[model samples]
Target: MTKYLISFEKGAMDHIPEADWPEVGKAARAVCDEAKDAGVFVFADGLRYDDGDVQHAVVDVDGVVTDGPYPESKELIGGVLIVDVPMREEALRWAAKTAAACRCAQDVRKFIDGPNNA
Candidate 1:
């Protein structure tokens, strides 16, 4: 099985009204449940970015740790979902479902196959 990253940027969800958030949450949860039932779900979560619900940390190669997020990034990933599947097409299909649920575009990419993958 290959692991694929399915993600969305924070800006992509800007158009969703604040009142619809709960319904959106339900839809996204449904997709997660379906994926879990299929035995392909590895992990999934929404990032706590607003109101400093979570703090970001950045470490340099010299071991200097700094509070993040990087000032250079124009958009941050707002959510992440990982699925281990046999093919890229299957991953894309899941991405579609996620995009529909979140009402945003999803960025899908495969993890490189290597010893580090395990």
Candidate 2:
């Protein structure tokens, strides 16, 4: 099996009204359930939007530690789903479902040297 990451960027769903979130959540959860039923769901999670809710731990080559999110990009991962599947097409299908449920674009990529490949 190959592991794939399906993710969306922060603020991707900002245009969605707060009132519609419950429905969206329901839709997304349905997809998650589908994945679980298919036995491809490794893990899934949504990140908190509040900056105060985010904390980062960075280790430098010198072993110094820094706290905070990556300074290079304003966008962060909004949510992610990791699936262990046999084919890329299957992963893309799941990503499409996720995109539809989230009402946002999904970025799908395979992990390098995943699992047994190593």
lDDT of 2 by residue, 54-108 (tens): 4556789999998666787556898999998999999999999999999999999
Q: Would you estimate the TM-scores of all the predictions? A: 0.91, 0.87
lDDT (10s digit) by residue, model 1, range 29-60: 99999999999999999876667654677788
Alpha-carbon RMSD of each model: 1.6, 2.0
Residue-pair clashes per prediction, in order, are 0, 0
Backbone clash pairs for candidate 2 read: none
lDDT of 2: 0.90
Total clashes for model 1: 0
Candidate 2 residue 76 Cα shift, in angstroms, is: 1.6
Worst 10 residues of 2 by lDDT: 49-58
* Candidate 2 deviation (Cα RMSD): 2.0
In angstroms, how far off is 8's CA in candidate 2? 0.5
- lDDT agreement with native, every candidate: 0.92, 0.90
